[model samples]
Target: MSTISSASSSTTTASRPTARNLGPKPQDNRIPVTPAVLRGIFASSRTPLEERSISRVAFFRFTGFLLSCLGIAWAAARGRGIKNSAALLGVV
Candidate 1:
């Protein structure tokens, strides 16, 4: 039947990858480790502790700023709300 023929063609097409026709493959172990690449890797690997120290400092500063803002907003709101209530009660 036509259904069986189409299914067989679809299976054959799907099983073949298209990359095989692109080009010849390069050598796997022939990659050159140049001086710049070596230096970049060494610098990246050596800076983890320094990066952690900088990140901690930045986090501490950010948290302190957020806490200060929250504290200021809370104090302002509480003060205004209490004043309004006291004024309504004829106490201020």
Candidate 2:
């Protein structure tokens, strides 16, 4: 009984997460695009859009962003200000 109590008392609680103990920071794999890079990408014929899938991926991502923005605007306008059906139609 004394040995069990001693063993339990000897065990330490888990330490909190510290910067040193925690593993290395997570890496972001995405390439950041600037306006100049975008202009170069669009203007340069050297870029083989056919050879890569990045264009298609970018197109869908951009389309989704636009749609989400539109939905948010519609919700904000209708949720608070618009009450009547005619006003809602006008908003649409």
Candidate 3:
């Protein structure tokens, strides 16, 4: 019983994470911008960037594509639920 407990405790301690084991904390001065967050910011009606950069323009196009996909998906799902072919094709 003692040996089993000691082994379990050692394993738990070894599995525990240290600061260096993980990436920078939220409080860190420098944090990298993720693509999802950047795209989301641009997808908003009002964007902060005045001058267009590569990332900004790319995200703009991506946002448009995503919006269109969502619209089409919504229409398709609605059509399926309501059993309306016209709505599925977005005719109405």
TM, every model: 0.39, 0.36, 0.31
Clashes of each: 0, 0, 0
What overall lDDT goes with each candidate model? 0.79, 0.73, 0.79
Q: Looking at model 3, report the run of 10 residues with the lowest lDDT sum.
A: 45-54
CA displacement after TM-score superposition, residue 87 of candidate 3 (Å) = 17
Once fitted onto the true fold, the runs of candidate 3 whose alpha carbons sit more than 4 angstroms away are 1-52, 82-92
Better of 2 and 3 by TM-score: 2
Compose the digit string of candidate 1's lDDT tens values, residues 6-55.
Answer: 99999999988797676656875576899988867766876789767877
**Taking the tens digit of each residue's C-alpha lDDT, what string does model 3 give over 1-92?**
99999999999999999888899767888657999788767667554464356568889999999999988888768767856667666787
Candidate 2 lDDT tens digits, 2-55: 998877766633344656787755665667899988978765755575535667
Higher-scoring candidate on TM-score, 1 or 2: 1
